[model samples]
Target: MLSLLTDQQALPEPVGPLTMFGPDFPFAYDDWLAHPAGLGRLPEHVLGTEVAVIGGGLSGLVTAHELMKLGLRPVVYEADQLGGRMRSASFEGHPGTVAEMGAMRFPPSATALGHYLDLLGLSTAPFPNPLSPLTPGTVVDLNGESHWARTSAELPTAYREVADAWEKALHEHAELSMMNAAIRRRDVAGIKAIWNRLVPKLDDVSFYGFLSSSPSFASFRHREIFGQVGFGTGGWDTDFPNSMLEILRVVYTGADDDHQRILGGCQQLPLGLWDYSPGRMAHWPEGTSLASLHDGGHRPAVTAIDRVGTGFLVHDKEGVAREYPAAVFAAQNWMLLSKIRCSESLLPGPVWTAVERTHYMGSSKLFVLTDRPFWRDIDPATGRELMSMTLTDRMPRGVYLFDDGPDEPGVMCLSYTWNDDSLKFAALPADERLEVVLGSLAAIYPGVDIRSHVIAPPVTITWENEPYFMGAFKANLPGHYRYQRRLYTHFKQDGHASGHRGFFLAGDDISWTAGFAEGAVTTALNAVWGVLTHLGGTTAAGNPGPGDVFDQIAPVELPED
Candidate 1:
């Protein structure tokens, strides 16, 4: 019998200082690059460049790649390593398999991303189909008793409510196509109007509250399952906080098979980007800082750009400094606010405060590598396949699943989720935490001897503690939906005006498809187009028109009950 563990009290407290990034974390990539040579000489020459991109993550990288294609030399600056939030780790003991500690799964409607994969010559396979109702997979309650929900259709009423919301959210806010009307005409006012009407609804109310309050939302018996599955407000806090209508717009616009994992790992995409860059665009000399205005009117902007005059000056954790005429402010909104010394104060008081106070939920993933296929037991009565399980808690909603091992059959991956409190629990000593997790797992699956089967120390990535990324992803606060209009609108306005003339903003936070990889790529493409148009490039015209693309794809068809 397979059971799921669903008690927080049983879990051990997390150990160590909450590893969050602050002003002290290195902001300039050159700092780390120069550490080997002990040479920290900053650049002083004016190297004319059309644009400077910051943050080597998908957004920055894709933007740079597009710029390069447009015949412009766009320099990229990464504060730490590439692949911003999409970081993966391979344990020493577990050689072939890898675990994603950061971003996971991509949505289907990401056409540009598909193009990116094609560019790198990477082929994708369908995600492993989840277990069907015939399998007796367990769903644990707060008391540690487990009950099985046969299929997603058989989920408890509460679970259904949340799932309904998820399905609704997906169809509503799936892609950028919904915003085509405003984007194509650059109708800032129209977008703002739509945003102003939506922000107030997201304040304070958790996802649970939204469903419960909605007249159209049907109630369910296992409402708590929503939290367990990480769907509702606290469970799955997305970057976009607009009204349900706007959120639904995103869901309906994007592709259906959007949720997919890369065959090798997320790292392959970035490494491929680095490898593909031409000699002129790829590697830069170590310890050589891009020129700044202070040296000779040749300021090279760092990741979070603040202001620019004769040259460019960007301020990040590295302190307020100037760079050459080109710079990229790739840091998050809060980070950008901290570094950039804006003369006009592009961000308003309320918006700035919201950005500062917004609390992002915490998340962590554990990849377990085994020498052999562990779960091969057959259920005599149902004969259904079981690949994963979901555990519920009174407080934190934790989800875990077994993924195909990278190189071999026996290899597997496990992932977990926790809110702020659960994250605090994760701070306990490793042994203690391990014991608690294993204890929980043992309760769910009495057959496996977890203590004896351990092959490697688990690798954990705490998004809450990451300096550059303050939290896993953005979530809608109580009233954030109302402010979202102003937030996105002003973000674009302030981003462009920050410095470097045509510098624009792109990322998960800014896009309507927030909290997904598709959002990141969509925004990056938009920012690139903006940059190209500013640079007098005609590539935008050469690219397939959004309308043409939209017309080619058939509309989604929902199944009948």
Candidate 2:
């Protein structure tokens, strides 16, 4: 964001703390959620009251963690593992060897996740993104050609042209330069001024349209090349059909850059939260952690949710039914239709539509425990390392290497494909997928024999095919902004009058910034505020949660069709 602020010239510093959401939605949630003072204490009457938390993902875990601090008992239910899409699967025999089938790289700008990360006392290093200076080198494979470079200067003329054009287009077409400045300074008004204009216009336009419309990308070839070899993550063609607003938000928020992976895996953050004892507690006994509260495991998956008097009745897969004054539905929205039976009247028609219409993109990742970081070895003939962090127009869209140590062992993500590319291997067995990936890598690296380095069977994941996660992450399609808005601000609606007051929604799917841990954390905070107020609690005098000032800060809602 700072880079954009000083693109043309520098801006004077603001007088005080910069607020990002402006006065209308005037709350610094990232700060408030992690505030040293806390998100206000619950009333004595509500303390220790049990709240049913569906899905034991990060959202549910964080909600349970925070609510526990304020003296509340959270009964969590998860069908699969503790971490939902934040999963990091370890290799069969190798203890520390792991593959991040879900979220691998996390951004620093996502302060909410950062807060929990800091609390857990975890460490991180820059993810070796393709063509990133953080790594030793990068390999770019495009249209049957390959380029090796430590930076853009070493890449071929076409690759550099595409990269420069994209940067220029972001500044002129997307107003990125100005938006970055506003966001960096925490100038809410300035952000709103730039974002409001882009939101309305960009929400309906496809990313392809935005690029084609840009004069900076004069050549169609450059546009296609730009999509295939994107500057940061690479090949956003799968996302070309998505709204331009989505791309802009990703770039503007730094979600696609300055990424760092958890040292062991991202899963440690949630699992750590479950075990870390807070400074204070409200129920049972002091020094009780979430793991201790549940006796080291989560409850069975929730099977049904129905309105029952002032509270709601929740039935788990084990046929046990319990009632709570309030509940947080932290699972994917699709679960409401497939996995769990939700009462028709639980939410209004618009809210239901938003949930049902929510789009999740498919993704596939193949990880192999390698003998060493052999990709960094120099080849005598080619004058290039045996390989570099690769980005290709081929099926293997992106490849990353996780180097534990020079000699110990390393993990290489052979292929990470999204959307259509992922769906290509939806039905293929792991062995078959490995074969296909090996073939692709062989083509990219002529005689390197990538398979010789593989010490164990490769691990693969196709998110959509997984029953627990129908897709990798939530993505907004073109013309779906209204549906997104409804889900994003569903808590502000008449939850009680609409028969949904006690039932709340929280997850990355329900937030404005879908598919990021930040979204998951932000929405969980929103649910906490909802449950707190519903139970007659209030934020402290100095600190205000989102719900406390929602009327002013609510996202701009487009008129319903």
Question: Which segments of model 2 are wrong by more than 4 Å?
Answer: 1-26, 493-498
Per-residue CA lDDT of model 1 for 1-561, tens digit only, reads 001111111423323111100001101211211233211111223123446676777777776665554444566666667777777677666655677777656654455566677667876654332322222453544456655554545545555455555545432532223233332333435433443343333334455555555543444534444434442112333322323433343433322222567877777786566556432321233222222111212223353444455345455444545354443344465556554455334345545665565445566555565554445455455463332454545322343444454345343434356555447545665455555666666666565664454577766666766776767766555545434433433323323444324445667665444566655665666565455434433222223322223223212212222
Clashing pairs in 2: 24-552, 24-553, 25-553, 495-501
> Residues 1-561, candidate 2, lDDT per residue (tens digit)?
322111223546734432223312335777796666678777787888999999888998998888788788888899999889889888878877778888888878787788899888899999988656667777778889877777766777776677667777888787876776667777767777777677777778998889888888889998887788775666788888888887877777677766799998989988888898987665558678988878988899889999898888999988999999999989888999898888887887878988888899999999998899888788999776788888888878888887977897889998999999998988898889989888988988889888888888888999899887799888888888888877877766444484667788999888777788888888898888888888887788778888877765566667665
Model 1 quality (TM-score):
0.68
TM-score of each: 0.68, 0.95
Query: Model 2, 377: alpha-carbon shift in Å?
Result: 1.9
Tally clashes: model 1.
64
Q: Relative to the true structure, how large is the alpha-carbon lDDT of every model? A: 0.47, 0.80
Best by TM-score: 2
Candidate 2 minimal-lDDT segment of 10 residues? 1-10
